[model samples]
Target: MKFKLLAAAVSSIALASPVFADLVLPWMSYRTGPYAVAGIPLADGYADYLTMLNERDGGIGGVPVRLLECETGYNTEKGVECYESTKAEGSLVYHPLSTGITYQLIPKVTADGIALHSMGYGRTSAANGKIFSNIFNYPANYWTAASAGVNYLLNENSGSLEGKHIALLYHNSAYGKEPIRTLEGLSEKHGFELTLIPVDHPGQEQKSQWLQIRRERPDYVIMWGFGVMNQVAIQEAANIRFPMENFIGNWWAGAEHDVIPAGDVANGYKSLVMNDTGSEFSIYDDIQKYVVASGKAAGAGDNLGTVMYNRSLYMAFLTHMAILKAQELAGTSDISQAEMIKGMEALEITDAMMAEYGLANIGPAFSVSCENHGGPGLGAVSQWDASAGKWNLVSDYLVADMDLINPLIQADSLAFAQENNITERCN
Candidate 1:
């Protein structure tokens, strides 16, 4: 069924005049273009989780969740179109999964009274939910990732980075540039030299960037790339004989497909992680039985335990919990966009709660508040063991340098509010 067209329905989610009994969830997926390899697994993981909910538990709170997947091909224009087409389907919440799209939809979603969860990628400043009411980027964001990367380096250098030279190799897009300011602020605070390297769209050609890296021999290289850019950059790093141990990629750049092309040469390369990867959680066994075994698994059912797959699972889990919260707040199974927004703002994810969902330690504990929707900026570092064909978390969860990141978020968010004439809420 598409969505409940509750003409006489008691709930406020009825967008049409047809009999329906489900809540609409929009997945703005990009299963094509340069990001297909990365996007496919994400989309599949999200779908499988919802499928499991329907098959195993008879849907969330006895109401089926109807997923509307629209392919964005990672294009901003297409992402907007997907949102416009699906909003009327009673989709109270949207997961854009694209920073460019998130930037464009912040105002639109606010105007429509819809909630948008950008997860780990999006406008880093959207963490200030007071200004951007309908926008959220919890668990972690780019600024946190940047600070976490620097924090890891500081720990390795005995709590200081003075005289060290660090370089940021990023995609020349809104998503990639999200970390530049934070990294720059971190460099100044730690007394380290910082270099910025930009890779064009699709990130196919990076010989010059790698050449610069080889020539400059920065003490460390942090990459913020996506899709083919990650694969190509890893190959280039291998070709240049850069010490894999000293090179790091943000979560987006560190996946199985990213390093498989370079074989063992990519071993020891590290990346920051917001959520633990792998399907070691009990949820996987449940998913296998309820969703996969029944032939309703998403895609080929082969991406169940991948990094991006687990991330998507985490994403779905958040939404699921929020929906339950929405039901509680609204005192009904059917919830409207306004109730969903409140649920998201008040949602809290504790380790104990995660274990209840069979996702113990999925990520650091986080709670969303009116003042802070971004959750505690906590992240862990994971390293690639090419011989083992897996990425392993090497450090305990580390909190971001919020002193540096908080100010940036405040400045940018305030500027946005001023430009858009948005009155700050949560007072």
Candidate 2:
């Protein structure tokens, strides 16, 4: 009887062993929605990179990663449900990937002591780490992208944009409206006429907006759209014979699926890029060898080198680095959510580290600090080459004018803090 009891106890311990050995990384993904064109590549890239780390390096810092993907369909309600359901599973970090969802989870995550790493597409004010203790929007944010886009246009126009009419065609959503404030501020500062056009969600129909654009004949058109909106906008621009070169899209609007549908008409259409696109990076080879070769690729290996795919890959890599840093700081491979937040806050990605990881010139070097969660707001512009079927870098890395962005971040973040009765940390 004692022997039988011993065997049962051993089995119970074995069953519980796996839980302690793995780290949960919950991914709020959207693979079956209107935005799936952009979502599929991003989900695949994020999952595949994490898979590669597990295969190539036995996970970050020797702790195997458990990637749990709960489809949010890019819906805010679904995203919150996914977070609530998975937060109890010892999730180390959360990447919501939607600004609306990110806004919803900001308070919930902060209360739960979980870190929300928005990467490039969440609350721009979360860049102020002092006001947002549990959130991180590193490398670049929407405001940064907006300022950089304006700066690039100014440079293209030989320093001054006086009397230049710039049209901003944006999706009428939280994500779409992120850049309007900064763009408006820049317009006031530079003496440029700014026209605002809002495209409703799903972004399938843009006929009236394009008709207005054609009638207005703005010198340049800046697009803040995603998914079907991007393709339809490009098609409409082509229909109106707008100069594709003068049409610029924010980072989200420049993916492969976005422009490929427009064919050669997409040629010369420019957009901002925070990281290098395509599978030429050394990490891709490793992914090809370790993950794809072993029949473990996330999305059939077709999206291995696209713009959105590469951006997601970079996001996963940075998150992995943060995990490693957290492990080191905590002196354990298995880290808690708080420890992961500390790791993300103290993380730094340098040029040398990029070169070592075979990501040379792929992304801008940036660091996370106690007071500043957003990294140096650096990005470049890429022009689509439909004939070449690729996006080529068109300009050097342009730094966003923090002079225009800082005050807004302060105002928004401070207001949030005041509303929530939370004290600022870096004051």
What TM-score does candidate 1 reach? Answer: 0.95
Show where candidate 1 strays beyond 4 Å. Answer: 1-20
Query: Each model's RMSD to truth, in Å?
Result: 4.9, 3.1
Q: Estimate the lDDT of model 2.
A: 0.91
TM-score to true structure, per model: 0.95, 0.95
Candidate 2, residue 38: Cα displacement in angstroms equals 1.0
- What lDDT tens digits, residue by residue, belong to model 2 across residues 319-366? 888988898999888899999999999999988988887677788888
Best by lDDT: 2
Summing lDDT over every window of 10 consecutive residues in candidate 1, give the lowest-scoring window: 1-10
| Global lDDT of each candidate | 0.90, 0.91
List model 1 lDDT by residue over 192-212, tens digit each.
999999999889999999999
Cα displacement (Å) at residue 412, model 2: 0.3
User: Residue 34 in model 2: shift from native, Å?
Assistant: 0.7
